[model samples]
Target: MPAPQRSNPAYRAIARLVRPVMMLVTRRDWHGAEHLPRDGGFIAVANHMTNVDPLTFAHFLYDNGVAPKVLAKSSLFAVPVLGRLLRASGQIPVFRNSARAGESLVAAEAALADGECVAVFPEGTFTGDPDLWPMLAKTGVARLALTTRAPVVPIAQWGPQDLLGRYGKVPRLVPPKRITVVAGPPVDLTDLYGRPLDAVTLRTATDRIMGAVTRQLAAIRGEEPPATPWDPRRAGRA
Candidate 1:
C-alpha cells in the first residue's frame, strides 16, 4: 500500500510557493528539527490541535528538507477546489470508519520506503480538552512505525490552536491569531520491533508515543500536565 517516490509535481509547486508565504505571515518557529532523519522515510506523529496544524507541519517539514505526505480525512478531499489541490499535493485520504485502515497503512509504508516523511495525527481528532494536552491516540500510527521500521517523530504544536479553536474547522484569512508549528525529535520505538503485534503491545506503544507528545505539549503550553484521566483507556474493539 506504500506510495511510490516519484516526484509529485503538484506538491513541489505548492511547497515552492507556500513556504515563503508562511514565513511572512507568521513568525513560524521550530525546535528539535535536528532529530528528523536526514535521509530516510519516517512517520511524523502529532496531536491534532486545530485544522491549520497540518499545513503548518507540512510547511515546516518541507522547509527543513523533508516533505511530508499527510494522512488526511477522506471528507476533506470531497470539497471542490480544496480537494483537487490536496490530491495534487500528495495528501493521503483515510476513511476513518471504513475497513480500509490497512490500505492506508500500506500507502504510508510505501511513502516511507521511498524516503518521504509521512505525517499522522495519532489522536485522530482535534483536542477537546480545553487544556490543549494530548488525549489517547489510536494504534494506526504505531502499526505504521512497526511495519515500515520508520522513525516516529513526536510533534508538539502550539499557536495554531489560537488561530482557530477546535471548533473553527478552518482558519479565517483575517484571523487575529498567528499560528506556529514545532517539531520535536524523532522517537524510536524500534525496541518494540520484535514484540507481538497484539492489542496489548499496540495500546502500550500508542500510550508511550502519546506520553511523549503530552510532555512536549506541556512544555509548549507552559502549563502543568493535565490529569491522568485526561486520556483513559478505552475498550479494545478494533
Candidate 2:
C-alpha cells in the first residue's frame, strides 16, 4: 500500500484533538477510499447536510491519509481559538458576497498546485430540500475544477443530521450516530476541459459534479433522488 499523506505539524496536532471526539460521537462506515488520489492535489466535493457534517467529512479524509484544507466562511475565522487554528492549519476563508470572495478560489488553486487536498461543500449550506437531498448548488466548484484542471472527487455522507439538525443548536450525543461516507471516482470533466467558462459551460459542468455527488448519496441512502434538484429561489426560500 502507498504511504499515507503527511499533514503539517499544526494540522496533525489539531487532528489528534478532533479525532477522538469524532470517534466518541459517531461510528464510521467509510467506503471507496481507493478512489482518493494516492498523491497530488484534488478537490473533494461533498453534499452539505448539516453543520456537523464537516467534522465527519474531515474525519474520513484525514483517516484515509489526506489532510483536507476546507474552504470555510469568513466569519468562522473571526471566532476566538478556532480562527487561529484555521489559519495555522491552512484552511481557506471564503469572503462571501464581497470583492474578496474570489480570493478563496485563488487560495484553493494555489493549495492544489502545492499538492493539498481541498474539500468543498458545493451546496454552500444545508440542503434546502425537505427530504435532505442535495439541492442545486452554485457553480464555484465547477469553476475551480475547470480552471485548475484538478481531479474532483465526489463524496456523499449521511447521519450527521442525527447529531445536529438543520437549525438545532443542541447536539444529541446519547446514541452515537453512524456516519456513512462514500467517495466515488474523480468526476469526468475531461470532455468539458478547455471549454469557455461561460454560463452554459459552467452550469453544465456544475450539474455533472453535483449529479455525481447526488448519485453517491442515493446509493448510500438506497433511494432515488428527485428528478430535479431543489432550487431555493424557485421554491421561494432564497
Leading candidate by TM-score: 2
> In model 2, where do residues sit more than 4 Å from their true spots?
1-4, 236-238
TM agreement with the true structure for every prediction: 0.86, 0.96
Candidate 1, residues 11-65, lDDT tens digits: the string is 7777667766666656565787788887788888888878778877776677677
Worst 10 residues of 1 by lDDT: 229-238
lDDT by residue (1-238, candidate 2, tens digit) is 2224567778888888888888998989999999999778999999997889889899999889888999999999999999999999899999999999999999999999999999999888888999999998999999999999999999999999998998889988879999999999999999999999999999998899999999999999999989999997797233
| Model 1 pairs in collision | 1-106, 1-107, 2-106, 2-110
- What TM-score does model 2 achieve against the real structure? 0.96
Error of 1 at 115 (Å): 1.3
TM-score of 1: 0.86
Candidate 1 residue-wise lDDT at 132: 70
For candidate 1, give the lDDT of residue 147.
75
Over 4 Å off, model 1: 1-7, 169-180, 229-238
